[model samples]
Target: MATLTSTSVHTSNLFSREAIAEGTMAFRFTKPAGFEFRAGQSIDIILLNPPETDEEGNTRAFSLVSAPFDPDLMIATRMRDTAFKRVLRDAPVGMQVKLEGPSGSFVLHRKAEKAAVLLAGGIGITPFLSMVRQATNDKTQHKIYLFYSNRRPEDAPFLDVLKEVARQNPNFHLIATMTQVAQSKGEWKGETGLINEEMLAKHLPTLQGPIYYLAGPPAMVAALRRMLINAKVDADDIRTEEFSGY
Candidate 1:
């Protein structure tokens, strides 16, 4: 568990934040003072407090949604509790918060020896967002497949941006699924089930030479890991980041 003790060099909140998704907030820490990290990495946020912890007694963990060379530190967060939800949901312009690290072990392989298949569930799309943003920004010719799952069309973060990426970039393939569509609009025509082996095979029939990066809730990660293994995806080729309510 990392603490909130930033060394002052990495603290910056001069940018704005917006609600990109229903329960998600995206902040642009412009040229974040001392924040330097890989595109697929994440960070820890230390909320202001009076020494009293929340019911969970934990800080927040979020993934960087911007590329490393974007000249700004972009992190997307999912506010799931009263404490964080209140702060993020009601955050006005110019509000400041604490953030640290470009943390995490999940990143795009730089050696060019391994390709990647990124799997994201709902708000878990943060890390993969960074990877895609980096790759797209750099115009790298890597074969990447992004499988993003959400409850419905409206729940999917960066929906339009992803569709545009898929439209413009042949190196990226973005597929989506909606588990429940009670609130979905009429424009959605994609799949409507949890990510499964069959879905993977259907979209990425040639899953021969790519690694897998999975990020999402614990249950989604666990179930998807099992399914990937059962589908003969090498365990070593799969990297996961579980959002455990930290």
Candidate 2:
């Protein structure tokens, strides 16, 4: 699939920042005039005149978490102790940043007849969240199955939002699992353990028909891809995007 050439760049100010999960934060930025992007896209945010610098530099790429119809652009990440994250975490509401292209081809399949099976781990749910939101808003006919795995309920970002989305969109099915729910203080009753072929078979009618989308750390993405391939799903139907982290 061809990706959008991100030639457009704009200067935007931070709108708000809030913690949505344990050690995770969602940052909203004012969208520049005439700026438009697909649901599953990413952008490079360049910090301007930071108080400090590091080997990672000032630019970081983040998936767009906010839907296209949202009032602003948003990105979420685990707040590490890195210089960039620290700056972003403490950034004033009106701080300026350079917003680069809405790059990446890891988007939803348009065929309404075929289903979309999304495998997301940790913070990798960003793009899928945008896609689900847009689908609900547009009243799309495509069926979506989201299998989101996290360490714990507290560790899962946007869990409540996704549950609400599931309630609002009948075409959207969410199966959120926890790999280490026992370690969490909060109560969880959903499926537990790493997402596997058996779990998928229980929820999905058949894995071979739907297009699969995977996103997460390198290891998780590779494992999910291998699982799909091992299940005899067509390799041509699998698409993946690995989040190396900011």
Measured against the true structure, the TM-scores of the candidates, in listed sequence, are: 0.87, 0.97
In model 2, residue pairs whose N, Cα or C atoms come closer than 3 Å (at least 3 residues apart or on different chains), thus clashing, are: none
Angstrom error of the Cα, residue 46, model 2: value is: 0.5
Candidate 2: lDDT over CA atoms?
A: 0.92
Q: What lDDT score belongs to each candidate, Candidate 1 first?
A: 0.75, 0.92
Residues 52-164, model 1: lDDT tens digits: 34675435777778877778777777666666656655555555666767577778887555667888898889888778877887888887889999998878889888888
Q: What residue runs in model 2 are displaced by over 4 Å at the alpha carbon?
A: 1-3
lDDT string for model 2 (145-194, tens) is 99999999999999999999999999999999999988999899999999
Model 1 regions lying over 4 Å from their true place: 1-9, 50-53
